[model samples]
Target: MTVENTLELEHLEHPDHDVVVAGGGPVGLMLACELRLGGARVAVLERRTDIDPTLKAGGINQTTAEALYRRGLLPRAAEAQERRLAEYREALAALGGGRLTVPPKFAGHFAGIPLSAELLDAADPAFDGAGPAGEVGAVLQQDVERILGERAEELGVDVRRGVELTGFDAGADAVEAYTSAGRLRTGWLVGCDGGRSLVRKHAGFAFPGTDPEITGRQAVAEMTGTEGLRYGWNRTEHGTYAFGPMPGRFLTVEFDGPPADREAPVTREELEESLRRVSGADVRIQAVHSATRFTDNARQADRYRAGRVLLAGDAAHVHSPFGGQGLNLGIGDAMNLGWKLAAVVRGEAPDALLDTYTAERHPLGAWVLRWTRAQIALMRTDPHAGALREIVAELMETVTATTFLVKKISGVWHRYDLPGPGHPLTGRSAPDLALADGTRLADHLHGGRGLLLDLAGDAAVTDPARGYAARVDTRTVPAASPEETAALLVRPDGVVAWATDEPADAKGLEEALSTWFGAAA
Candidate 1:
């Protein structure tokens, strides 16, 4: 049974939309934006009518931040999140430690371990290694939902809140959905509903992965004896305790294992006891405002698409909140799947193109799961792991080691193994290098179309781009990089489909265009 307040839907049975997305959270909303951008009719069915106001946790990694910027939603996204992470870190460092110092952040953290700017700079040597290769920002999850929802609406996506998908019947061509809002049919249905996804379960998708072994909790409360309860992550023999950027906001990880009752409420007395046990301090809780429990339970769907029904976000994968990658991962899923799915829906690409979604994202999802698993293992209270953690912490201070991890955590290193001649830039996020005239390479992708960026102003690149004139946008800009980057063929999702460091080769470029964008229009 669904927990949302149910309402009677008007349509009993009918093909109402090209796509019907189940779950209107940030992931679903972002997909709606992408679909709308592709001129596809999309609808989002959300279970919640109102946004959750609780300040549980907030932030997005640099990778997702770039996606928002590419779509011109960065202004709105910036308004939603305050990138005051440095302030938050400063507060924590002030708690008690050596002169804990760090460079300006370019990447996010893993288990409270910071990835520095110097590391990213050494690897790319561009962007001055200051932040994620592109934009890097953070906002509360609720604000993320709000901004994406507004963007979806702006793109004309139909969103119906307070309606939940109970089940769906999938066929070779379409999906027949049964929801609290009645019956509806769409050419495609994506389950962004969440971890305990009704669609995934009903569709018989195998969700096989590790289960939760530890329980993490966050609470906001009125408390006394705030002494020694300063900001920063602290480890105890029992577990981990962290106090905050704001007063009375606290978090603890208890190694007693996952809660027997995952649904049980966190009471004030229990919160106080946990604080005392984890911190080994006599902290007293006076009143509790709100609290939630989570675990490191990692899981992923064996397949992303099951016939006409699909899955994204928590429905497709779930992991511990160690690095703040869960939401970012889901948003990335939406961004990657949106354009490809829309192209298939609009008959601009063949059905086989849809299969690549799993081919690209499932490995990324698996990596996230392993990444969180490593965090869990490192953050444990066990003595052996504690020693290993100290070694890693020390190693993170080095240039090469730190740079490697910075790219990993920032997700800038994610490169799909696409069909290419192994050009270093292939299958990577197209560099947002600026031309002599001051236009950036990323700007050309704002329209969500393929781009053949000619850094050399080469005639060779423009000719093939003309073959697929309707699908690819060709732009000749001044050579923007110190290295040889003659031209880059970029997919709408901003991944490099092909690249040439010397000069554009017509045959190579044409093959890339046809492989990704289809036969020249």
Candidate 2:
């Protein structure tokens, strides 16, 4: 039975919203949009009065790109990416001299070790039918937030900025959130409030992980004597430093430890000291524009959900920003939780479905923690770490190892361990299939509803989903390729719930539909 149907009369009549998202950043905004698309009333509470323009993640991996594309926002994301790339190019041209040469095909890096994109295999099974979703994006964190925020507005999400969620009390039926503005009741409370999540902590969620071992800083500054510093990532005798994707941008990593005062503002003296120590250069900084500090500190919540309060993005997991995984991981978390939570709130699914969020994403989040920890081990200035770095660099030079690392970094190598028939595609992100009608699979997902595609033109395959019309959109289209599956059930988040290589299985299709979409309407 739906939670709303089982709730007491007063509880049903008094709850203010279906879901109230704490923190209106990209993750919260994305989740708010998804909930609206699922026909749920959502409100987003953001602490900041204005968007934070601090320089953060400069790109989105394949998984995040696909999430945007599925919502018809890929074009906007691509435009933002191109604009940033042009600015970077213009900055480099201003330097005139060939101090740094951009690689023709740079995939990404691990432990500051650049991975060449030229080695990626076109025929790799991981990307067989990924289509446009395989493209990585170059948008910054601010741009990402802008894109999601705009979409959230278009979807009629009630976003309240300058309002902070101080604390909340979750009862048997609903959660009463006490914010800086006032108190509001909600069926669910989601903490996308970043690493220092008040919702997660207030809900008594346990957070456990290692402490910081390194202090890293990045900034855009006006400086002199930068010529003495090497281009790109350089691991010197003391620590690591990198110069210029843009002319004035500088980054330094010192292994002594995390900064004594992480909240302290960046100063000209501090930047000069770090640059001199890492590069052994006599660089003098005249002015500092934008700067941020980070550390190797890593942690993840023991669970993503605690009763009616749940967590996403940095609230659920956090690690060193190595491999540009922090933003991508958070985006993945929102996309995974969005539809499921909406289903439960809309009274279309049971709360048991919410448990699947942690089950599926916890393993992946743990893997990311381990992945960043490995980079820290390689980045340490110790002799043992130096030796290990050399070995890893040699392995990265090979096509096989490069391809493997690329898969993991691109966020396309994992799958949800869903219960279904033993089909290779089940539990994996659905391929962007090219239908005979000239539309792709992503075109049908813009409305945030589950999909049932009948490629074999069988009445039985399409008939089983008739009862689920409220939550599933069924389409009978000719197979785009001879080897395409006869039928497939794709969840709203673009995961394949079931697929059949042979003739359509009516009973199996019905069961799969019932399992994921709840009993027929």
Candidate 3:
């Protein structure tokens, strides 16, 4: 069934918006777009009037790539990927690549160690029936934000720029948010406002985790006498440093604890000193273009929701920028929460559906923290850490180890624990299947509604969704393997809610529909 474009048709006592998002970054904008697609009224309150042009998160993992693909924005993502690759090539050409060594097949890195693309198993089960989104895409953070922000505008999301969310009071019915612009009423509030989230703080969520033990600095500058630095990531005796993946981009990690003042300006002298300390190359900085400071200070909210308030992205969890998992993880959170929240607001599903957000995402968030912490362990400047790093590096050269690590780094191996599974595909991401109509399964899901695919080609298989015609769409898909899966019930976020290898069972299908899409008509 097709959804209407109408908005804000709730009762008279309904709040001004269904949801008020506290940040207008990529994750926030993505969530707003998802909410709008699910037919919810959403408003994004952003503090910055202009997009920050800082160089951060130069690529997205496979999971995030798939999310964009399912949303019909794959072409834009492809353009962004091509642009990033062209820029990388141009930068390398300017560097005059003669003696400088770089990895031949760079897929990704783990704690500065290169994970080769050649080592990945092409026949991995994770790639079975996967589409173009199974691969990673190189796109900057600002580029991702720009893409999502434009999509949000087109979707009719009310984005208020230069207006910060100061505080809010969450009541039983709705949340009254006090913003820099003024007070507003929203049924729910989500904190996507980065690490220093006022919504998370005002909601009194317990944020507990490890403190910073390293100060990391990244800069793009014009410099002279920098031939001594390595082309890619390098572990030095003092700290770690990487150069030239992008023209003058330089990064240094020092184990001298966190910075004294995180908000302090990054000067050319400071960057030059860091390069010397890590590379011992005596390089001189000619001009600084863009620079930023970071730390490995990791923390996670004890719970993601409090009453009518919730958190996502950096507001929900934060860690070191070691593997570039922050943005991908946040995108995953938005994709997971957006549909459920919208359903609850529309009174289609009970509020209990929202509880599953914490149950499913908290474990993944904890795992990311552990993943980054392990990298920190391998990055320390101690002799023991050096020995461990050497052993790990040797192991990483093997195909088995590289394949395992790449899967983790690419974010393609995640599987949720949904209730009452029927097939192995249950609770996993639904693969993009080639439909009989020459379209793909992802094409049917662009509207942000649940999907019931009748692989058995039986009319009875589509009957369970009759009660939920508005919330779930039914399709007759040409099953690639009827022996493996005869029917599939997919959530709006692309997660498989239920699957059946045997013939389609109406009882099981109805249970899944009621579980995820509320009581049947």
State TM-scores per candidate. Answer: 0.90, 0.95, 0.95
lDDT of 2 by residue, 311-427 (tens): 999999889998999999988998899999989988889999999999999999999999999998898888999999999999999889889998999887879988868889999
Cα lDDT tens digits for candidate 1, 242-293 = 7754456788998777888877877787788888888878788888887878
lDDT of 3 by residue, 1-521 (tens): 01322223232124468899999999999999999999899999888886898768878888898899889988888888778777767666776765443435447888999888888886888767668776547778888899999999989998878778888889999898877656788999999999988888899999999999999999999988777777789998899999866678899999999999898999889999999999999699999999989999899999999989999999999999988899999999999999999999999988999999999999999999999999999999899999999999999999889888888888778999888755688888898887667788888888999999887887667877889988999988685533467778899999999887666565577788899999987
Which residues of candidate 1, in runs, are more than 4 Å off? 1-8, 82-108, 113-135, 480-483
lDDT of 1 at 500: 88
Q: After superposition on all CA atoms, how large is the RMSD of candidate 1? A: 3.8
TM-score: which candidate is best?
2
10 residues in a row with least lDDT, candidate 2: 1-10
lDDT of 2 at 256: 89
The regions of model 2 sitting more than 4 angstroms off are 1-15
Model 3 lDDT at residue 176: 89
